[model samples]
Target: MDVSQVFDLNGKGAVEALALVEAALQEQRRDEEVKLWFKFDPPQPGGGETLFQPVGRRLRDAIKHGHAVRAMPAQGGGWIVRLAAKVR
Candidate 1:
């Protein structure tokens, strides 16, 4: 499944968005071939920043023990995280 369909942030607050991601990861565990990518849009300038770092850290930890994969931030403020696990 596409990452967008599996995870969404439509109008939902940040906390809920993080929760949704956690839940999806839990479910993906059943399938060994699942891969996940979480992309967060840059916060509006001057707007309070989202706690993406902490959340991202925790996510990294959670899947670290599993087959999940993750990506670190790139230059120019672009971040891409990919979680992949071997199926079968």
Candidate 2:
């Protein structure tokens, strides 16, 4: 899913984005994972590591049941978020 369409790097936006992603995943019939892309603006004050923290927390908190979530830097200047069903 296009995270840009759902999130804007703000607290409220992060919540909304996670909701959308969770809903989408719930509706899917296949076992394929869901991936989201987010492009963040350059870090302000606290340096690079602080950039995606809030969104990352929200993503992790949104997971329920047996889903797994992870976020990592993308090739460009953004983050790649992934969500998948947990393996047994």
Candidate 3:
């Protein structure tokens, strides 16, 4: 499933972003999907990836469980993080 909601965490930091992802993941269940869209620091790809490192690790774990995530740069700054898990 695609994520229709884009969380505007413009002024938030990586910690906040990670927290949001964690919270979203918690509510997710098997056969369900959770795609998150949020902003993080640095704007550029390098900084964005570094800032999202921890979050990426978490998402990687989710991937092992049949989940997936993607990150893209936003127009203004930061990144849009998308997390998803498909129903098996």
Candidate 4:
């Protein structure tokens, strides 16, 4: 999927977000083909932040161990991700 339409975010921010997604995918084993989708906060700071958050170290380690995460845009401008085993 192009993934560009995944969110309304534009410019460098969008690129950064996409990069994070890719990194998340990479952490999940050496799989070459994977799919993911999700929505993140629009850069507002508060208790009501968006559901999606950055890929922390622990999650990254888990992914690197062989966990694939597929995310998609959910209601309330958040993200819904599916965690699965890696193929390779």
The candidate scoring highest on TM-score is 1
TM-score of 4: 0.36
Model 1 alpha-carbon drift over 4 Å, by segment: 1-6, 29-32, 72-80, 84-88
Candidate 4 achieves a global lDDT of 0.47
Point out where model 3 deviates above 4 Å.
29-34, 41-50, 67-88
Summarize candidate 2's per-residue lDDT along 1-88 as a digit string, tens digits: 4442323343335456556555654544445566666555646675435446665565566454345466666554455666675444
Give the whole-model CA lDDT for all candidates, comma-separated.
0.55, 0.53, 0.57, 0.47
lDDT of 4 by residue, 1-88 (tens): 4432343322335447657656655564433444344555444666453324543333444455656454445554545445565554
How do these models rank on lDDT, best leading? Answer: 3, 1, 2, 4
Listed in order, each prediction's TM-score against the native is 0.59, 0.45, 0.50, 0.36
Output the TM-score of candidate 3: 0.50
Off by over 4 Å in 4: 1-12, 29-39, 42-71
The candidate, 2 or 3, that scores higher on lDDT is: 3
lDDT of 3 at 63: 60
Residue pairs with backbone atoms closer than 3 Å in model 2 (clashes): none
- Would you give me the overall lDDT of model 2? 0.53
* lDDT computed for candidate 3: 0.57
- Candidate 2: segments with Cα more than 4 A from true spot: 1-30, 45-51, 62-65, 85-88
Error of 4 at 46 (Å): 20
